[model samples]
Target: MKYTVSIEIAMPREEVIQLLADPAHLPKWLRGLVLHEPLSGVHGQVGTKSRVVMQMGKQKIEGTETITRREPADLREIPKGSVVHFDREIVVEGMWSVVRDRLTEAGPDRTLWVSESEYRFSGLLMRLVGLLMPGSFRKQSQQHMQDFKAFAEHGKDVREGKG
Candidate 1:
């Protein structure tokens, strides 16, 4: 399955970059995130592999996420008109996935974030879930973007359970 979702955040591109790159802010917007610890390389750097654990309802899914690409390693001085890119590959027992994220300046003080995700399942159970409820994947992606926008714009925390 593959799908793309996007949202406009009322913040400068630079600010958005900083917030997204910071592991400290992940829990604030990434709902159900229980852990995101770097296993190798520097956190957020290209080639870094992180152990990710998320609690989705009654089930807990754990995966290893590897950072495949990060454009302009230095974020201190991003030139105008440059679109920031962040790409990663995730692997678990029965599924393999990749996500590509791009952030661009939408206006003087606004940012547009686009995320494209693809998933491949192996086990029968996993494949069935992917086949029967493909829209759920897209919906979850959009929810993350919306949660991020709220967090970035209004300092809302997903864990708080209140918008």
Candidate 2:
């Protein structure tokens, strides 16, 4: 399944991108995120790798993400300036899934974050499980987007002495 959502942040694109790129700040804003460990590379640059763990209800999902694309902030462009794209692979025992996030600046102090995912079931049982839990996937993705929006906008305000 594929789903996407975007929000306009009240802060500049650079600030938003910078905050999103930090691994430590993820759990603060990302709902259900319990752990984020950087495995390699710089904080926001390409080639960075991290292991992320998120919990929803009684279930916990673990994944590893690698920065595939990182664009520098361009103040002149304001909102449409920079973008950060990454690919994440989630392995749950026998089931494997892949998700990609393409986050870009949209307007002045606004951002557009899109997440696309393609999941492959390992066996008939896994396929059946996916069929039964379709809503789980969609809900998780949407919740993350909402959390990011709140975090970025609020974070911007806090940083600019607005809060």
Candidate 3:
């Protein structure tokens, strides 16, 4: 499955990108994310890998993510000025997922953050979830974006929305 979601943040594009790129800020906007440990390569660089653990209710979900692409916003001549891009491939259980993030400057003090996600499932259970609960994936992605918007705008945690 593939879909795109976006949110507008009341912050400068560079500030939004910097806040999003920093690993230390993951827990602030990733909801259940409790751990993000770099395992190999340079952190945030392409080819770098990391283990991520998230606590969802009583379940502990774990996954490994490989950074596939990282592009600065200012250096490109895209229609939108200063639109950064980041791509990561993540595998969890029987699921393989790729998420691409684009951060574009909407104005002098506003940013537009977009996320595109693709997910494939191997196990019967996972495939069923994909088929039946596709909205779950999109909801989670949008939640993270919303949380980030709140965090970037007013320094709030994921649980503390509308910051």
Candidate 4:
């Protein structure tokens, strides 16, 4: 299954990209994200892999994220913001996920945050979930985007229920 979600963040595009590019601040916007640790490669560089752990209610989920691509491949260029893409494999549940994050400057202090997610489920149960309850997945993703917008724009700690 594949879905896309977008939001408008009232912050500079560069600032939003900076906040998202850091692993330490993940929990502030990634909802139930409990752990994010690099497992290989040069940190944020492409081909790097990381372990991601998340908790939703009583479910403990684990995934491996392999950085597939990044924008601004060169340092010296017309400076703006980032339009990065990454692919991840959910090891625990046999899901393939890719998310492309695009940030565009809307104004001097506003940004348009657009994210597209593509998911493939391997297991029968997961496929059932994808086919029968697609809205659930979209809603969850939208919530994450909204939470990130609030966190990035207003400094509202979404993980703390302030957003």
Candidate 5:
């Protein structure tokens, strides 16, 4: 399955990138995240692999996420009109996924974030879920983007249990 979701954040591109690149700020926006720790290399750097655990209601999903690409190693100075790219591959017991994210300046103080995700499932149960409920995956992705926008602009923390 493949789908793309996007949202506009009321923040500069650089500031958006900074927040997204920082592991310290992830839990604030990424809902249901239980733990994310680097297993090799540095967080956000190319080739870095991290263990990710997310809680979804009564289900717990654990996976390994590997950073495949990051353009302009330095996020401190991004030239105007240039887009920032972040790509990662995630692997779980019965599923493999790749997510490509792009960030561009929408205006003086606004950023546009686009995320494209693709998934491949192994095993009958996983494949059935993917085939039957593809919209759920896209909905989840959009929710994350919306959550991040809220966190970036209004300091809303998903862990706080308040919207």
Candidate 6:
């Protein structure tokens, strides 16, 4: 399945980018995420890798993510937009799964973050699992977007000692 979500933050693009780039702050705002490990490469740059673990009820899945794109922050220049896309292969027990996410940003003092995910079921049994779990998946994605907005915007305030 493919889905997209967008939110406008009341913070500068640089601040938004900084918040998104930090791995330490993820669990505070990223829903379902229990662990995030920076694998390699420089922060906020393309080719950076991270190991992500997310929990859903009693099930936990792990995946490796590589930053597919990055745009530098520019204050004087107009906000041209940026995106961080992840290609993920998740494993649970003996089943192999895959998903992808694309986060995009636009507007001054604002961001339009979009997450798109595609799932591949291992077999007929897994297909049944997907069918029964549609609501959970949608809820997880929606919560992620909401948490991201709250974190990015409020995080700026907290850093400025306003929160």
lDDT score for candidate 2 against the true structure: 0.65
Q: Name model 1 segments beyond 4 Å from true.
A: none
Q: Residue-wise lDDT of candidate 3 within 40-151, one digit each (tens)?
A: 9866888899998989889998999999988853333445575578999999998999999888888889888889999999989989999999999999999888787778
Worst 10 residues of 4 by lDDT: 73-82
Flag the better candidate by TM-score, 4 or 6. Answer: 4
Give candidate 6's whole-model lDDT.
0.60
Candidate 3's displacement at residue 141, Å, is 0.6
Give me the displacement of residue 111 in model 1, in angstroms: 0.4
Candidate 5 lDDT tens digits, 23-102: 99999999999999999999999999999999989999999999999988888878899999999999998999999999
- Report the C-alpha lDDT of model 6 over 1-163, residue by residue, as the tens digit: 4444455666665576567667677766776777777688764456666777887769888876665544333323433454545445545543554445444455555665555565656677777877787676667767776677767766522123332
TM-score on alpha carbons, each prediction: 0.97, 0.73, 0.90, 0.87, 0.98, 0.69
17-87, model 2: which lDDT tens digit per residue? 66776666776667777777778876545677777787767989787766555443332343344456666
TM-score of decoy 2: 0.73
* Candidate 6 positional error at 54, Å: 1.8
Segments of candidate 2 deviating more than 4 angstroms? 43-45, 72-83, 155-163
Better of 2 and 3 by TM-score: 3
lDDT tens per residue, model 4, 1-163: 7778888888877677778777777888888898888899865667788898989789988888887776664323427554544344445566777877666777889878777888888889888877898898789889998878878777778667774
Instruction: Give residue 16's error in model 4 in angstroms.
Output: 0.6
Candidate 3's displacement at residue 106, Å, is 0.7
Task: Flag clash pairs in model 2.
Answer: none
The numbered model that scores best in lDDT is 5
Per-model clash counts, in order, read 0, 0, 0, 0, 0, 0
Q: What is the lDDT of candidate 4?
A: 0.75
Q: List the residue pairs that clash in candidate 6.
A: none
By TM-score rank, best first, the candidates go 5, 1, 3, 4, 2, 6
